[model samples]
Target: MKAAWLITIAPFAACEPVPTAERFIPDYRGVETMLLADDLVQFNVSMTNALSARDVENYAECAAAGYTLIRGWGFARHLRTNVDEEAGVWTADAVYTISPALPRGISTIDAEVVSAACAEKGIPTV
Candidate 1:
């Protein structure tokens, strides 16, 4: 019985002390304020393709000219193509985020130009 008791208590003896709440709490109010401001003035956009680095730069340039944000994703093709190609039917999708205040007409042109540029770079788009 004494040996059993020692075995149980030995584990607790080596436990580390818990930190106080003050040590873990962060100044989140500033972050929250920034997020709120961003919500008011940011736009969201995306593109789907399989373009190489040079192609991506071209797309980025188009996006910048139109005042938007952009990113890319990978998908499968009938045959292996770019670095991101997989075995099955997959595609790469690029995304962009921009401010909401920009003119709506330019946004459409932005999407067209970026999509075309990606295609020219060997990145397919639907």
Candidate 2:
């Protein structure tokens, strides 16, 4: 009986460990930026190994923040973000309004602050 128990436990010990953050590290594919209007912009981002929709949305937000800075803007307000995943690849279609002054919304983002956070998080920007 002891031998049987040891044999079962041995196989369990050999099993692979649980997934870690390194295992799920995302592969940022690319970002496409489009100017919808004077201050409105659209960001399309794609990636793989995304753990959740929030990852793709963050990518889009990062792109938007970078674009805002590039356009000499200091802020961006999130309009919308749509996330999709297929065949293990995640994509996000996001829209934002860039402005020199803070936009009148709760989703406003400071371009410099968000860009720095994105860099620290290893997320790519436009």
Q: Pick the candidate with the highest TM-score.
A: 2
Clashing pairs in 2: none
User: What shift in Å separates residue 100 of candidate 1 from its native position after superposition?
Assistant: 10
Model 1 Cα lDDT, one tens digit per residue, 40-106: 2221222333233333333333433233322222111111112223432222223333343333433
Give the TM-score of each candidate.
0.20, 0.83
lDDT of each: 0.33, 0.95
- Those runs of model 2 whose alpha carbons end farther than 4 Å from true positions after fitting are 1-23
What RMSD does each model have against the real structure?
A: 18.6, 3.7
Estimate the TM-score for candidate 2. 0.83
lDDT of 2 by residue, 22-58 (tens): 6688999999999999999999999998889999999
Q: How many angstroms is residue 113 displaced in model 1 relative to the true structure, after the best TM-score fit?
A: 1.0
